[model samples]
Target: MAVPVPRQRDTPATESAQATPPAVAHATAPQASLTLLVIEDDPAGGLTVPEILDADRHRIRLRTARNLTEAARLLTQDVHCILLDLSLAGTPGGSGPGAGPGTAGAGTAVADQLAILREVLRIAPRHAVLVLTAEADAERAAEAVRVGAQDFLFRDELDGRLLSRAIRYAVERKRADIAQYKLAESKLRAQENARLERGLLPNPLLEGSDLRFAARYRPGRSRALLGGDFYDTVRTPDGTVHAMIGDVCGHGPDEAALGVELRIAWRALTLAGLCGDDLLSTLQEVLEVERPCEEIFATLCTVDISPDGRRAGLCLAGHPAPLISRPGRRAQLLPYENSGPALGLLPKARWPRRQVELGGAWSLMLYTDGLIEGRIGEGRERLGQDGMVEMINRHLDRGLSGEGLLEASVTEARRLNGGELTDDVAVVLLSRTDG
Candidate 1:
């Protein structure tokens, strides 16, 4: 009687489940038994070997295929390993003339003999394979091993105990090889991602400026370094410091790329002596042309501090007003009354530059809406402008400033949201210390 080998067949979903799950879902239980498919064509009958036995004495179930066609039919996910008779003769997977196939006009040489082995390997990439051959073909057997076979067994050495052990060992060794490949692949992928991250994020151009800058950015997507939110600070050759933060509409790679484009455009325009409404109009043109879709839009906030550092020009393109904190004064939002429609939402719109006094020493924070849109709890209440202002005041009471201030604010926001904030958050802080 053929032993029962309980195994799960491969489905698209099953293949995906075999991969690591992102969230909780069905778990695959360990397979109960292993099945081996033996390929051979003996004139009288199938493999003459006796019934194979596993280590637990449970009989190793066997399925015999006389030719390549039958072998293809028997190859299934449930079959854990294969025992192929290399000496057997037939076409590759029951196709073409079996005499010679590898080269255009070569005879049935060693290459053709091993062509069947190659076909078997191609058809069953994830399964383990072992070869059965005569002792006179020991050279061919070793060559087969080099080609991809797990091991080769001589006809005289074929026994129930040796096969069972070989089956188990071959299965384990195949799994180890796959695991090592995946590890190497993942490491290489991570290194590439690190390179991408460095390229995407900008380096501040604050040379010869006394403005201390700090920033905090987090992508809502797992394992992502850049997001749809972007920001940068640079000091103009005229000694005026300029900083801006903006957010593209979506939370995807395309959106992230768009954000980077906008940041670069802003930097180039600022360096080329564009500011306020003119720079924004040019950016709007860039946005209208570069956005992935007509419906896409971006919110932006830009500030240009005068050479003396006591005042700044603020422009809001449907973005939140920056927050300003000075000694003896609680942190508060900058004026947003003159804010215009977000870019791409209006044609030929104008962003008015509002002049504001910054005092002698203060910290100015510009951020994307993500920082304020997080849920306050499990409830529908969001940490809107009012709530964010209040939170910043509390942090100010704790005497936090610069990097520490930004980190604490983000942590508190996430804590209040009950988990990670489900949007890309980007916050930039620029501080000036004047005697």
Candidate 2:
């Protein structure tokens, strides 16, 4: 059922006027529709911006602001871009101290406007901001870009198509800048962390000891080089070699720094012939002075072997007891009784010195809590004392001794956690066997 539609006829004069002009056939373009905020302070006559069309010929939806206060109010999440008029009367707010050089006195006003742009960048890190400057002040427009604006547009050349393209480009450029900036920041942080870790980790000074030294370290903080875990070993003049391992309660850089300080103080005191209670007491004093806050504390375990290398003295301060294994017997934990609280907890805390008989052929293992605390399987149970003992026995049966033992333990712990342990794990193995 088709029906015919009638067409209206026009007079000769109307037809002639409706014909296109010679220049009307010039290359036309499309425009894109975008939501934009125009910050202008002409109260008498509101913003009279020419229709800004994008490549698709869709006119931009414009919101007008007479002042900074109104502009702030109109800056909703939906506002994709801001077009700020430089001739706007009110000064911007919240300028920080690091305003660029040559911006002093009334230049402070310009600094404040730049600060506003910076704040906007912070708030809408992905949004685009284009400054509207007069033709003569085009240089200032460039400065605005340096101050974090996405782009600057001249009022004389301001048209719908140009404004739309500028907005699109600014948004994309701002996004790229943000991503690149974050990547660089991450790289710098990683470099700093690596340097700090080199200072925190333990270095074995067992140059002449017949015993094999092996150790491994892992920080719990994701992608961190080191945590609050620290260890050190040094052989003194009296042929009495001292070894220590400890852990602070946190995984921050401050905690790592404190751990390093404590380890250095321990080495200094031990080398100065301070042992047992005197050495530990001095270290506690150091912790009290150097710790960032009173709440910070550190746990430690230290071992000192005599010149003959047959016997050793062990001291513990709120730390896990070290494991010992002899040639013909299963490994066992030394009796850890009457151990004092961690350092910086109590001024008069006492760490009991216990005697452990290490035969000519024996190995002692010291480690932080991160090793045994990992989950063994999908269960809620942890690979605690029994698990560690069995694991060590199996390794000993396989003739895995010295550094090999420490490597096995660390690798096993990571396997149990299904990946790297989520805490800082530092393990030191001292094996003394008749050569």
Candidate 3:
């Protein structure tokens, strides 16, 4: 490392040496200053590098390390690439190439020959590496690439121009490879999230039921489709329609998954003929078991519409009361007296179900707090339940109903909040047009 290193253009090639590509350097020369770290037993003249200029005609700075220890000390973020000598003997210990460390001496010849290369890769996972070996060891040079090296170079074929070009090429190729890997990983994650979102937002099992159903859902997390909000609607065999909306304590993945579980359990329990306090108790039990933590709880509102589609049994577990909008009457909150504590909070909580009369035609709007808790404007004032009622009245005056009404309400909430809401929102509309 202390001796005079070979400089390609300055050093005369032997008559038997292969001709080097003079144009490769000009094409691959890095635009900015590039540092090359050379690790070898003898950098004094093992390979040409001292005063070797890059293809850009800029001087390629060089750092020499006699061993792995010295190389690590010199390995800095500024080091763009590494030129490792494959023939370099193992460190004083039998821990590197030429000396076996982990495995026995059976068929580890390839591993042994590339031990130093592997060590370099371990220490510098981000650095572009180029292996220096004899031209006869072509297969091993390629194996080094498969082992995570950026590229490999033969000592006989290496010159100032070839080394410079290889360095630039290896660095760019490594960068491209990293970008490609991230793109692939993002695609896989998006696919998985899509599948989860579909499971969370289930299709209502109202095939033979006459009640109309519409829902709007949005997650709080950026680039996320599913958060802590969950909802489901299903019709029992007896012709009764069951709809439920709930929000977990947190918006993290654990909370979102738990919400989905509760919604599914509610649907299953409803279809199994469970209703009123019995259904609510079973749901609370499921929440206690499925929640990620003891402190985590969920606010839920479940309504079971009678077979006549005019009356519904309402149960609020620390949730907002549903808004009832009739043909000739103003929209208002339903009776929420004696509502029980949120699930996972009380051990033997009793959610008293209230029988409500739904005249001839009515629209029951069930939603989580996310819809009304958003800031009304830049001020600290929120679009609370009162504000939500006024907003709904305005939309209704415009004749918006079903999907249009839900979409407009949520859109207006976001606009009033100044941007996207910080919490997940889930709204469900159960409308019956017949008297």
Residue-by-residue lDDT tens digits, candidate 3, 79-197: 88998887665322223444436545524555554666777888898888998887887898898888888888888877887888899899899889889989999999989978876
Comparison by TM-score, 1 against 3, better one: 1
Write down the lDDT of every candidate, Cα atoms only. Answer: 0.83, 0.76, 0.82
TM-scores for the candidates = 0.84, 0.72, 0.82
In candidate 2, what are the lDDT values of residues 1-435, reduced to their tens digit?
111111211211000011222353244532234678776554344335676654445455677765445566767777778877654532322122322244354565555556555655555666788888768766777888987788898888887678878988876787788899999999999888677767666667777777778788888987767789999999988788899999998989899888888888998898888999888899999998988999999999999998778889989999999999988999999878888788888989888788878888888889889999999888878888778989999999998887788888889878887887888999888888776
Instruction: Select the stronger candidate by TM-score from 1 and 2.
Output: 1
Find the candidate with the highest lDDT and give its number: 1
**Candidate 2 C-alpha error for residue 336, in Å:** 4.3
Candidate 3 segments whose C-alpha is farther than 4 A from its true place: 1-32, 43-45, 50-55, 90-109, 221-225, 292-294, 326-330, 359-361
**Top of the candidates by TM-score:** 1
Model 2 CA deviation exceeding 4 Å by range: 1-34, 44-61, 90-126, 219-228, 248-258, 285-298, 307-310, 326-330, 335-362, 375-380, 395-408, 414-424, 432-434
